[model samples]
Target: MPGRALPVGLCPDMCPAAERDLRERERRLHRLELAPGCPGDPPRADPQRAVKEYSRPAAGKPRPPPSQLRPPPVLLATVRYLAGEVAESAGASPAEVVGFVADRLRAVRMDLALQAAGDAEATVVLEAALATLLAVVARLGPDDVRGPVDPVLLQTQVQESFGSLRRCYARGAGTRPRQAAFQGLFLLYNLGSVQALREVLQLPASLRACPALRTALAIDAAFREGNAARFFRLLRTLPYLQSCAVQGHVGLARRAALARLARALSTPKGQPLPLGFVVHLLALDGPQEARGLCQAHGLPVDEEGRVVFLRGRYAEEGRPPASACRVLVGSKLQGRTLEEVVMAEEEDEGVQAPRTMQEGDAPSPRVPGLAQTI
Candidate 1:
């Protein structure tokens, strides 16, 4: 019995398929072993298991797979971390932290957009995240930081978040309803998207009745009709939240008007635009402010308080990025010369244009007086 050889294929005949596979694997593993490291060595780790073990997060701090992640929680964590940090804390500046959080929220926004395509719950979460972001912006006011914070990126992310909100609202129209419409109206106005604003104006009368919607519509009207006097008045009277939201865009709109005026009034030879004219056109307080704005934009102003239009092709390039919003607004107004739009609105409404416009006055009937709500 000791000298007897086992029959060929006996193991395969005697064992089940799974047992045979295990035995064969064990035999191959044994063959690869250089030596018996110990009388009973621990079982070798599976190759896949080994990789997973190495890749796994640190012990006791398991993270959900990315597919299972919910963005709002991540965003909240980032915000909370920043909120807890102090001046001497080992962390980024408040501005940097805010910017980083904004970027993360924007990414979450895109994720929300995708999720909202198929799930209503995702839409709700997206809105909550957006609200959180808006609060973050409010808390990081210009005066809050010791160092200057560039709100440009934060503003951009907010605008993009509004876009995501808009999409979610559109998708949830059937199950959700008027809420999305009104919120979207606010967002489109905040974004200063004139074309979108016009489209929304075509919504039902009930939406038009909302104070915020009414305000946004009036602003759009004032801007489109070239009623700088009226637009500025309405801009100042905006509801508290809307006022803060549109501060950047209002500046952008004014800058755009200035750029257009420059291009229109500039001649190949130096022609100075009257400071008074520029002020009235851009809804500025006075020639001094007009001069300041011109200087800020690199437009030369003579000692006589007249803006000297640049000589040639270089003039267009002189405009800032904010001018793009102005151009977009202008195009949305159907390329009407500012005067034409203003005059046409006045004529069509059977209302006489103000004989002599003054600072902070309503330009037409569509614009409310200083004390009047939009």
Candidate 2:
């Protein structure tokens, strides 16, 4: 076999198509050299050098001087406006006010996210904003908000905000007391959670010695031990904001305490317990609340305003009605506003350990060992 001729004016390796392809490949190689870090190019002497370089501005080009950036003026203005609205809008329905406050706070928080992380001035504004929001939330009652608020969601927001604030400022001596107080409030709000207790325990001894924290811990212990008398007593001693923080759990504690009473006091023969004694024991406002609590739990009240506990008749099916504790919490405020309450440093009013009742001093008639333990 012999080789065939290709085309006129073209050699085997010098066809017009091949020539054009060679020119195209050479153009690509030339471009690759101009493009930094292109594959198939020789490695640079400085292996760590950036692959791309940005040109400096021309001398005539206007440029901003390097200076500290601040939080947007609009953000601070919005926070102040919201705070003022919350504080001065007593005429507005609490639900409407709380809704506005919550929405504005969320927007403020998002705005804060875009700010520089190391901006201390911005962090201070954020802390103040969070405090104001938390104060507004803590002060409003469920009935006051009239179902506009999801308490659990609000609590989650509080937890997140507090965490962020702590990360930014908890180490500062000026903030340590406030942070400790907030921690105590958090612990009281989650009284039954083992994790909450563990976190409090992990805090420094000095912080744990904080009056609010110590009181909260004692209350937790009382609750775990099922000491209703001691629990209510400690609850009565909390500061206003702290009381507000734990108020949601009060009904639960009361129900649990009542159940314990029923278990201990129930007999084949019904026992009539005095409503006045219940009011004292549970730290209720009055005999009327005591009677109402008993009735709500399916316990009977006699004509004499005493609760009749019969083991067979007691019902444990329904949630207890919320008792009003405004008198208790309000008195503790001593005429402080919500902002003042939230920002105030806790005083060193020594926390007194609740005294254990002597066997003879048990106010209610107890079955030999059961009442002693309760």
Q: Which candidate wins on TM-score?
A: 2
Best by lDDT: 2
TM-score of each predicted structure versus truth: 0.45, 0.69
Report the poorest 10 consecutive residues by lDDT, candidate 2. 45-54
Q: Which residue pairs clash in candidate 2? A: none
Q: Give me the runs in candidate 2 sitting further than 4 Å from their true place.
A: 1-88, 117-135, 138-146, 169-175, 348-373
Q: lDDT tens digits, residues 175-294, model 1?
A: 343343335335434555666775576665765555555556666666665555566656544432344345456666676666655556567777676777665545455677777677
What C-alpha lDDT do the candidate models reach, one value each?
A: 0.46, 0.61
Q: Per-residue CA lDDT of candidate 2, range 1-374, in tens? A: 12532221111111123323443455422221123444543322221111111123457863312121123354455455556544446656655565556655664554445343344554555655665665566566648644767766677777776666656564444444365666777687788899889988988887787667778888888888778867887788777767767777788888888888888788777788888778877778888888888988888999998898888776766556766676556567676655554444556433444454455334343344444535
Tell me model 2's lDDT, rounded to 2 decimals. 0.61
lDDT for model 1 comes to 0.46
